[model samples]
Target: MKEERELQDVLVQLSSLAPGPADAPKPAGQALAVIKRQVKQEKRAGCQPWQRFWQNPNRRWATAVLSLLILFTVAFSFPAVRAAASDFLGLFRVQKFAAISVSSEQLALLERVAEEGVSPGELTIVNAPGALIPVNSLAAAARETGLEQVLSPAALGEPDEIDVVEGGDGRLIIDAAGARRIIELAGADPTLFPEKLDGKRVEVVIFSGVQQSWDDGTVLLQTTMPLVEYPGNLDPVPLGEAMLQMLGMNRNEAARLARTIDWTSTLLLPIPRNVATFNEITINGSSGLALASLDGQYGAVMWQQNDVLYLLTGSGDTVELQRIANSVR
Candidate 1:
């Protein structure tokens, strides 16, 4: 059987170089010589001392180990892989949320704003700030990732209050309920500002947040926008990327990825979903990820950098949010 297998192998090779079967009538002597010569060449091809190295048991292991090393080297050397790894490494560096407070008058204004009517349900701050202090604390993550503008410890106020009193964290805090009520009364939805949401519901809440205190008796305001507030028809990654770019990350990938997002998905934000997801697509040959807020109503996307994360938020005020996202350093 072994001999038969060898003969077949030899036959296949010989047939490749020989004349067609029609010429099989050639003299037996020449045919025998050709067969013998073919066998000799096949044998010689495998006879080299160097060729025999492949047959060594240790060499086979060495080759496998060497190949693995090369693959690993290449994998770690890739820019995409390297960036992802770096991001993972730096992710733990994010700071936790800090609680904040405002002056007594601002506290009074906040209470009045709530009286003016935005629902607490609309106010999405995770932690509740005390009544007298005024303002809330927020996850450092939001500010770090560029969602700062969409979120606030203070509510939106009238034009003069635009910079009414800058919080320790450098954000404009106002009695948003009052301002929003006034604006909406004029037919505007705070979410899609300038163009009112057209829904005739009363919003009556002043969102309080975690508070962070600075050395000068000043406190950084804590804040978060409720998922119900604005429809973030955007993926978190793209949102983040937009936020980052707006905040001064002028790299090509940040710019390219930020542009790929359609503002439509941002409308989905207010709709709730349990398992929101974010997908990162390659932009200009660089890596990016979209955060689908995993909720049905909205999603936002963001991109990862060695030491930063960015997100998108707010629809009508998207330009404003973009301005805010860009406001980050």
Candidate 2:
């Protein structure tokens, strides 16, 4: 009886998937073809399993298996349909847990700097754990796309050594040993860093300051460009509707939810409140953000120029930071 009830419930869900009568848009060519095929297959009668499993008269078990198989096939094949499903089901979502697009430890550093707020002349060890990547040499890294070759602050004169690193589509990471080596060479203590950076592969350029102590004297610059163009209203609405139709979703509901999403013009970056002062400033005649540590002794100034984001961070005066930022050509 329990099993029968479960099977009935599934049937009910499946039945409810059909789109209702409405002014809903029609599916695209490919999607319409698939949907029509699915309907035709459902109407056919035979237990040819591979050829037409849904037509099997075997009842509950075969029906359930075939239905699941169809759902998986459609979901995997169509992205619009997948998006509609995710939106309707609310199964997965992206969440923001911290700021700076770096590690939790790097978030802590930003927050601490924000709290200190401008203690001039105090050379503090402003750590950017995840943001830093080690490279064999900048010359080697210059060969890759989406990376900068020339970047250095005139305020710091000459760096002891420079490093370059890249990240892939997913957040790239380095082991603790590599992180330690990076920090150590950059004149920072390896012990002060976390085990991993789990950060995206934006281009990072590190300029080690003339400090024997790793606690102070480091300048880091990071740049990132969008990997993929913003997905505008290009998703075929009918395809989404068709997908929902497969799941027994009503046409009206599917049509309304399957429409393409228009993301906002500006991407939001959530920086921790305690990290520094958030001030909007003009960079090369464009809007930008300048973050100065609580002590005002260290800071990061950032701006998006030509779709590429530029971040200059160090324990230096804001004037110098801006100058370095302006110098990035």
Q: Note the clash tally of each candidate.
A: 67, 24
Residue 280 in candidate 1, Cα distance off native in Å: 24
Cα lDDT of model 1 by residue, 150-259, tens digit: 23212222111111111121111123333334333322233322223222222112232333322222122223321112322323344334222322334475447445
Candidate 2 lDDT at 178 equals 39
Off by over 4 Å in 1: 1-206, 209-228, 253-329
Q: Which tens-of-lDDT digit does each residue in 139-257 have in candidate 2?
A: 54454334544444444554554444333221112233433443333223334433332221212122221110012444443334333221234233443343333333355664674
Q: In model 2, how large is the Cα lDDT of residue 142? A: 51
Instruction: Report lDDT per candidate.
Output: 0.30, 0.39
Kindly state the number of residue pairs that clash in model 2: 24
